[model samples]
Structure formats: C-alpha cells, structure tokens
Target: MSAGVVTRLSTLDRFLPVWILAAMLLGLGAGHVIPGLGAAIDAVQVDGISLPIALGLLIMMYPVLAKVRYDRLDTVTRDRRLLLPSLLLNWVIGPALMFALAWLLLPDLPAYRTGLIIVGLARCIAMVIIWNDLACGDREAAAVLVAVNSVFQVIAFGALGWFYLSVLPGWLGLPQADLAVSGWAIARSVLIFLGIPLLAGYLSRRLGERARGRDWYEARFLPRVGPLALYGLLFTIVVLFALQGAQITGRPLDVARIALPLLAYFALMWTGSFALGRGLGLSYERTTTLAFTAAGNNFELAIAVAIATFGVTSAQALAGVVGPLIEVPALVALVYAALGARRLFSPHVSGSDRVRQA
Candidate 1:
C-alpha cells in the first residue's frame, strides 16, 4: 500500500468502531422517533434472515478472510509457541474466564446472562483479524491464528455453548434446562454468518489470484473490501441497537455491568498471551499478533447465534450486542497501548521495523 493509502487505512481502523457506535445511536434515535422505522427495518428480510444485518455481517467478514495469507500456513507450524498460546488463550482461557465472569457478575437476568455466555463462548471469527492487523501484529501468524480460531469455533462452539448454559449456570444457582434446545439454531446461524462468508471470500481470493494477479488482488481488491466490511459491521450494529433501544435505554447500568467482566477478560487474555509470546522469544510483531488474536471475541457469530437461539428481543441477545460496543473502544485503546509498550520495552527496534513487524 502507498503511504497515503496506509494513512487512510489507519484512520479508518481508528474510526470505524466509533462510526459503528454513532450509527447505532442514530439508528436507535430514529427507531424511537419514527415509531415504525424499527419494524420497517426489521421487515427487510431474506429467507427468514434479516437482510440488513446479514449483509452487514457478510461484508464485515470479507476483509477478515481477505487478509488470510494461506501461503504462510506452512511456516506457522514452525512457530509452535505463537500457535499454542493463541489456541489456549482463545479456546481455553478466554472462554473459561468469560463463563466465570458471567456467573459471578451478571445478575439474575436470564437472557442477559445467557447472552454474555454466548458472546464469551463464541471466539471471534471476523473483526479479530482487523484488530490484530491494526495492532501491528504479525500478518502471517495472524492469518494462521484466524484460520485456526475459525475452525475451532465451528467445531467447539456448540459444545462450549452447552457447557456454559446448561452446566455452568446450574453450578451457580440459575439453572435453565432450555439451553440445549437452542443448539441446532445456533449451529445454523454460525454456518450462515461465518461459514458462508468465509468460503465465499476464500474462493473469490483464489479465483482473483489466478485471473487478476496478486498485485490486483492485494492492491485493487483488498483495500476496496476493507472499508466495505467496516461499513457493513456498522450497519449491523445500527439495526441491532435500534431494535434494542428501549431495553438499552432502560437498562443503561446493565451495559456497564456486562462491560466490566469483558474488559477484565480482554486485559487478562491480552496480557497472558503477550507475556507468553515474549517468553517464547518471538519477535515483537508475532507477540502483538498473538496477544490480540487470542483476546478478541467473534461478535458476529455471537450476535447471530444469540438472535437465533434467543429471540432478538431477548436480554441474552442484547448482551451480545453490548460486547462490541465495549470491545471496539477498549481495543482501540489496547492498540495504542501495545504500540507504546512495544516501543518502551523494545526501544532498539526502529519505527520502520515496528511497522514491518506488525
């Protein structure tokens, strides 16, 4: 990318999340004032799916899959430290912490607590890649980590979801038997939101590489798709928040409660992954990449599954929506923090090297 292009991308990276939040606020206001606007927007559906939301998620995931450097997967096996830490943090530690926090902090609200668990159990399948890249993570390592997380999410999400809802909640005091009933619906939503977009992106990249050359694929296509994905994600956020505007307005404090555990989860996971990366003697870029890839949650899948499993109006679904609102801003701060920390600790590494390492 050219200097101007890189600069523009960086600006979008910083602002996209804010823009998403703005769109959500605007949509919420519009939905409230216009009376029927929320229902009208809700009516925009295709094959029992919400078109605007589905389109947003579809485009949002494109950039993530676009960045997957499948060519580098061979090299990933050699970096076992980075790979292992990423897997453990994302799959094991992150989910466990989220489940624990949900039980401990979330009040007796059934839907809200379930939603938090859903968000926690579903590892990030889309925007984690963007955060990882923005943090100046190792691109090759990031690509591999994203792919690995995607696979694990597909295979393990249902089992983990069951554990969090059916088993963990009972251990506390709020046991719910209906948790198992949502599995099939959750699975289908995951397939639609994650599986379809991933396959389409991968196939398109493969075809584009063969027909249009790597330069065209990377320079011409990737840049165009990146912002589109962010816009789509924002649009989805708008619809989601608009639908839940009343609930959000009434339960403002709930957002803070949900955010606290998530913030703690993010800090703990990022720190643990970063420390593990440094202990492994990996380069700064690789360490940063692992830290973020492990820390981020796949809100797209979580939100979709939440809506499907629990009604869109359910508190559980609302909690899933709240996740990104907190995560986006927090992650932006973490990116800056990562950069500064990297510079402070590894002062010998030049700015150019830092960028390259990312």
Candidate 2:
C-alpha cells in the first residue's frame, strides 16, 4: 500500500498555493495603492531588524525545528550511505550548481544573481520535512537531515556566501559580485533567524517530551503549532511583497528570470539525488527523503538574510521572495514525481513499510 501522505493534509495545507498567491496580491496591492505602508512596516525595527518580519521568520522556523527528532540524529550519523551523499548534495554540489546557474542565467543582474546564490547557500531546514513526509519518505531520516542542515547552516552559511558571491567568481574570471554584508552580518542574520528558532524548537521538544511524553508532543502539541510555520511564512511574504510591490509589479519578467534558474536547480537536484540514491541501493523511502531534502531550499532563512542584508525593497530580497513562490508548487509536483518513480526501485523495498517503520 502507498503511504497516501498528501491526502492526510488539512484543508489549509491543500490550498497553500492559493493562500500564498492571495497574500502576495494583497501585499502588492496594499504597497502600491497605500502610501507609507512599507515605511510604517519598516519603521518598527529591533536592532535594525524589522520587528514584524523578524517575528514572522521566527514563527516560520520554530515548529519545524520542534518537530525534528534530534535524538535520532545519532542513528542517521551512522548511516554513511545516506549522510555522506546528503552532505555532498546539500553543501557542495547544491551551492556550486546555484552559483553556476545564477551566473549563467542572470549575469547581468548581479543583485538577483547574488540573491539566488544566497538561496542556494541557505539549505532547507523547514518545509522539506512536509515534502519528504508527503512523498512517503523516511520520517526519521528527514528529521535528522533537517537538524544536520540547521547546524551546517549556522556554521557555514556565511563562509559559503563569501565564497560564492565574492571569492569563487573572481577565481573563475567572472565578474565578482560583492555580498555587501560582512560575514559577521550574515552570521548574525542566520543566528537570529535560525539560531533562536533552533534553540526554541530543541528546548520545546525536550521539555515537552519530558513533561508529557513523546506521544503527546508529536500528536497533540505539534499539530497545533505546525500550521504556524506556514502562517509565519505567509505573513512574512505579505510584508516582503508589500515592501517591494511597486518594483515587483513593474518588472514581471525579472521574477520570471529568477524563477527559471530555480526551476532548473530543483529539477536537476531532485533527479540527480534520486538517481544517486537508487544507484547507492537506498530503499524507495530513503531515496525519496534524499531527493526532496536535496531539492528544497531554506527560503525562510534566505528571505531573512536578503532582507537583513539588503533592504526589503532590493532586487535581492525580491529574488529571495520568489524562491517560495516557485519552490512550493515545484516541490509539491516533485512529490508526485517521487511517488510515481517508486516503481523503479527493487520490488522488495516498500515505501509504505518504510513510512510505517519511520
């Protein structure tokens, strides 16, 4: 039997794209039609970070982190077949691929190109979980991988930002782009946006489980807080698009341009990872986890960094915002693609069985 994971989503999740689109339009309209709205939003800042936007980002990250079974990380670490390939895909190949695509596709638009590279550097620590689960992937693997990503994101994101944006391009004889923000600045943004949520989620999971046990934590507590991720995501998008509404509306083709490379990146990454996993003899469920996790970008951290580094109205921020606009639907479609590709694996490897075990 198939996992039927996608069928289990609540109504709000089923029509997520619609709600996001509506939020985008609403923000854009409010920004364009209403004067000073963006300013009003920007005026409220804590330590130079927009308060509302910061809140939304924190909310977006927390529940997803909370859902991770950090305890299972030891198990994942022992599985070098899975862990090694995932590290190579996420940190090395993923960033290099995006850098190449950004330069090739958006050489002229340095701002957006750098923005895309930043997206690549910020690996998915949030929504990949849902995509993995929906694709009937290994749940333990997904949680552990995401936790690994969060840790790597903290330690390496700034350095990768520097390498891709400033160092590597010069080495390749391409026009070197300035990241503008210092490494410390990028680190600060990642720390605030990711670190806070990471600690909160870790603590929540630990304390919640200790107090009421794992069953209540996962079944009762998680379901309540889980939706907050998307809610925070939508809220942040509205605020972001609101700030950049005029610019986004003015340059429709630019958004499309940013999207094309992202589309290529996702397709290439997912397919490549899937093939790699199957060739490595991973089960269908593990392969699906590997593919989705590899394919997904952490747009929450991307947007936060873009906005924190470059103001919300900048083209860089716009590129970061377009990430989820494309990723949500793209990855959702890939979920189905993964489900169909299940037959390609050995008949002995059952996805439903793996899901049940996870």
Candidate 3:
C-alpha cells in the first residue's frame, strides 16, 4: 500500500512541471481568446479577495495539510541532530537568503519580490519526497524533516513571510516595501488562506482515521485527494494568467525577470545547505536530505497565500507561478549533482548506509 502511494506521488511529481506550464499557457490563452472571461474572473471580489481564488487556494493547501501525520512529531525531536540544522536552514537561513537575493536582484519589482519571499518562507511540503528519494538521501531523516516542516509551514510561514514584507525592510533600512499595508492586513490574509486549510486538514486527518481506519486514510483516501492541490493549482493558474493577460502581454519579459531570482535562490540554497551539512561532518545521507529540503519550496501554499494576500493579477501571484517553472528543473539538476557528489562524503558513510538510514 505504501509502495503504491509512493509510486503515484512519483508519477505526479514527474509530470507536475508539464502541467504547470500548460496551466500558464492556458491562462494566457484564455485571456487573449476570451477577454470577457478574464474580465469576469477579474470582477470576482469578496471582501477584497476573489471567491474563486480563495476556494482554489483552499483546495491547494488542504490536501497538503491533511496528508501530514502530526502524530509522528515526537520522532522529529528524537532526530534533533538532523532536525535542528534542517530547521535553521529551511526557516532561518533560507528565508533570509531569498529575501536578500530578491531585494538585490529585483529592486523595482516589489510584487515579484513579495512572491519570492513567500516561496522562501514556505519549505518543501510533498515533492521533497521525490527529491530526497532521487538523491538517495536518508528517508528516515526526510520523514522527520517533513513532519517538522509541515507543522512549521502552518505556524510560522505566514508570520515570517509577513516579517519579510512588513518588518524586515525597516530593520534593514531598505527602501520601504510595497508589501502588507499593515500588520492587520497580513494577519487577516493569513487567517483566510493558511488558517482554514490548517484546521480542516488536521480535523479531517483525525476524524477520517477515526471513522474509516488509518490504513484507509493513508492508503486509499490520501492518494485519492493528494492530487487535488495540483488541480487547484492549474485552475488558479488559468484564472490568474487569464486575468493578467493584458499586463503580461505588455510585459512579457516580467516572467523571465521573476524567474531569475528564483533560479538563483535554488542554486544558492542547495549549495549553502550542502556545504553547511558537510562542514559539520554529517553523514552524506543526512546532508543530502538537508540539501534537498532546504532547496525545495511549497509553491502550492505560496501561490495560494500570494493570491489571497495580493490580488489574482498582482505581481506576487505572477511570482508564485514562476516558482514552479524554475524549481522543477533546477531541483532535477540538483538531484544529479547530489548523486554524483556522493563519493565525497566520509568513508564511513556508504551508499548502503544511506539506504538503511532512510
């Protein structure tokens, strides 16, 4: 049953890049072919946020949250040797690095900057499994990292993302950011976007297991719904690009502009994290896991949160779409790099040991 789940996830991850691009094209096409359709979608607003976008964001986040078995959180603490470094790399250093890079790279484009910040704040949610597995990293450590990150993405991603938007600029004495008009603005946005899915996902996991049994929940039910986030992603992408078609048409170069910082972010984070782990003389298995985890981002949640906070047509939303465009191929390349570099680890840490450790 577990094998089946992993296989399905692997297949889905492999094809996700194609679907994201398709969604981008579809969105752009829909806007051009049917301007009225884009207008209609643009007209959708409820309390400053689009209803369809809110629903799509909910769909994108709920499955991710529901799939996490928070019950295993105890084990994460037990592996703090591995877990602690991952936490700092993912939450502390990763976000800071992306923020600095985004500011330095995209000085004039605040929306795109905010989007990159969102991506930075959100650590890998699901796809890191494929990344870690491909790199032959430690699966046990991956599980611990995933469990911890799942909880943190909910509790911390919003606050820290807001910090990047609202507080960091002031602290760094950088130009005032276009982000978060006020603290309450981001607080409200977080409640609607991240809060709802978090509650629903936790309750669904607990209640579904109680009603149907754990095996059914993980093996049968989760596999069924896990792909809904992607569906939501595609739908949201279609609507967003459709709505912003005119803007995108005028500024076709903006896509590439947004993508560059993200590409830089992935390369920078992977190398830095890998070096940090190796510098500590950590096992290759654990170091590889950290490298992948630190490099990956939960763009699903980031996209949802961006659209929720900014408008569907905002540059922030555009930044969200650009993330997957770069992350998929970049991480794939990193997988090869990790595999090729395996021999450089301590002689005591063999490939066979990684398999057993994972």
Candidate 4:
C-alpha cells in the first residue's frame, strides 16, 4: 500500500486481486445474462481445450518464461538441495495432502472427492510459472522446477491418479473410482501447455539477448512484455468462469462444498512448502519458487481429464471447474503473503527489493 510498493508494481500488478475478481464476476455475469455464451466460447477447441483459454495461457506464460536466465539453469539443476526438496514436495507430499483433505472434507461427496484427488495428482506445469514470477521467485529455478514437473506429469500423472482414486481408497475400505485417462492425452496437454510457451520464451530470451545484449533485453524488452502475462491471466480467468458460470451459479452450495478442501489445500501447501524451504536454508526467491510450484495444480489438465473420463455434466467435472475460481484469488492473496514474509528472510534481499534498489 506504500507509494514505494505501488511504484514498484505495475498498475496491473498492484491491483491484481481487483482485476481478477472483476474478471471472475464479469465472466459469471456474462455467462448468466448472455445465452449461448458458454457454447460460443466452447465451440472452438484444440484437442478438447477451448482455443481462447489456450491462447490466454500461452500469452500468460511466455513473457515470464522469456525472463528466465536460461544460462543459469544448469546451476539450478545442480542444486540438489532445491531440486530434491521440490521433487518430494510436489510429487509426494502435495498429492498425499490433497488426497487426505479431499477424503476428510468430502467423505459423503464421492464424485467431488474423486475430482479433487484428480486435481491433486495433476501437479502444476503452467500457472505456477506466472505465480512464481509475480511473487519474485527465482526465474531460472522456477523454469527448471516447472520442466521437472512437466516430465513427471507426463510419466506419473495417470499412475498417481489410479493410486489415489482407486488403489489407496480401496485399501482404506472406501468406495473407489476409476480414472480412465489416456497417457497420450496427458502427454499432449503437457506438450501444448508447457512445450509451446517454453519454446517461445527460450527463443525470445535467446534471440533478444543475442541481438540487443543481456542489458537491453532484461532492462528494456522485459518490462514491455511483462505486463502481458497478467493480461493473459485475467483474460483466461474470465473465459474459464464464463465457460462454466451457469453451472457454478446454479449449484452454489455444491461449489462451496468443493471449494472448502481446495482452500485448505492451497493454504496448507504454500505455508508448509515455504517453511520447508526456509528450514532447508534456501533464499527467498528459491523458497517462493518451491512454495508456488508445490502449491499450484494443473487445473486445465485436471478439467480435461475429468471431462474426458466423466461427462462434462458430471460432478467430477464440476469439481474441476471450481478449481481456478478458488485458486486465482487464493494464490493472489498468497503473493502478498509471500511478499510480506520476505521481511522474515531479511538480510536476504528479494527480486522486488533488487528491482527497487536498482
């Protein structure tokens, strides 16, 4: 709220929660007021994903990825302290925690519970990048962690889905659900969502630096394009909510029921991950990266899998739809939380501090 902080953030960055809330409300209003809005938006699909949503994600992600110091990626990969903890938190602790929360919170609502578990299994490969960047997390470190997650996502997602939705539930004497997901579909989603923006960002960084030098690219080009990331995010939120606004409004109680576990999951995962990172003696940037990556989920993939396996009208799919509705606002608040928590890591200057000092 200080002028110093206000000056440090772009108008879009400063009022991010406001913009996101308006976008969500706009999408919901438009969806409710305008007939066939969902159909119109849903008409154009890229392998079952809405084209507009896909474009928003690509735009949201590219600039942040472009800002990564790719040359320093080797150093990030070599840091076992960061890499190993990230892997464990994302793959092991994250899913397990979600599974427990979903079952514990939604015991009677099996379909929603299954959907939340599917959400849990899908570790973040996309929006976490934007959140990480917004929170002033390490760019190189985030890029590496994201890439690692994408690989694990392609390899482990279905297996984990089975383990959680079917295996583990069965072991516990709970009613089990089957997740009939295609490996190729999962692979394709990862390729399209992560692969495309990653390629664009890499090329943009590489060529921009080569042509204009690192100083020009970082100082001049990045700021110009950086705001686009948030623009894309807002657009995506509007479209995402619009696509399901009618259902969301009609089933307010159901949406609230599904939202409870998700709220708990994000809060717990982010706080725990941040604490773990600090306990491991990581810097603020890497710590933020670890926390965001661990806390975020691939909702796009979760929705697609849920729709593909269960009908779009199914409770499972509705649970997937509720994901970003809760996530966008919750994580935006956490961005501020991460910023405030930076003071706890004092004597350890943050990316925002470096920019302010510069």
- Predicted candidate 2 versus true structure: per-residue lDDT over 105-210, tens digit per residue: 9978999998899999989876686678656687668867876887787778877888887788888888776654555655566577767887998899999999
* TM-score, predicted candidate 4 vs. hidden true structure: 0.96
TM-score to native of every candidate shown: 0.81, 0.81, 0.65, 0.96
Worst lDDT 10-window in candidate 4: 349-358
Please write out the lDDT profile of model 1 over residues 1-358, one tens digit for every residue.
2243245345666555577568878866876777777678778986557777778778877776666666666777687877887788888888888877776776566667778777787777666666666666666676667767767776788888777777766776767634443545545666777678777877878999999998898778876776776677677777766765666677789888888888888888888888888888877778888888878887766766777767777777778878877787787677766665665345454221323210
The candidate that achieves the highest lDDT relative to the unseen native structure: 4
| Local distance difference test values of all predictions, in order | 0.72, 0.81, 0.73, 0.90
TM-score (C-alpha, index-matched) for candidate 2: 0.81
Give the range of the ten consecutive residues with the poorest summed lDDT in model 2. Answer: 349-358
Q: In candidate 2, which residue pairs get closer than 3 Å at backbone N, Cα or C atoms, i.e. clash?
A: none
Best TM-score goes to which candidate? Answer: 4
Q: Order of candidates by TM-score, top first?
A: 4, 1, 2, 3
Name the regions of candidate 3 deviating beyond 4 angstroms. 1-13, 90-92, 103-180, 274-358
The better candidate by lDDT, 2 or 3, is 2
Residue 53 lDDT in candidate 3: 70
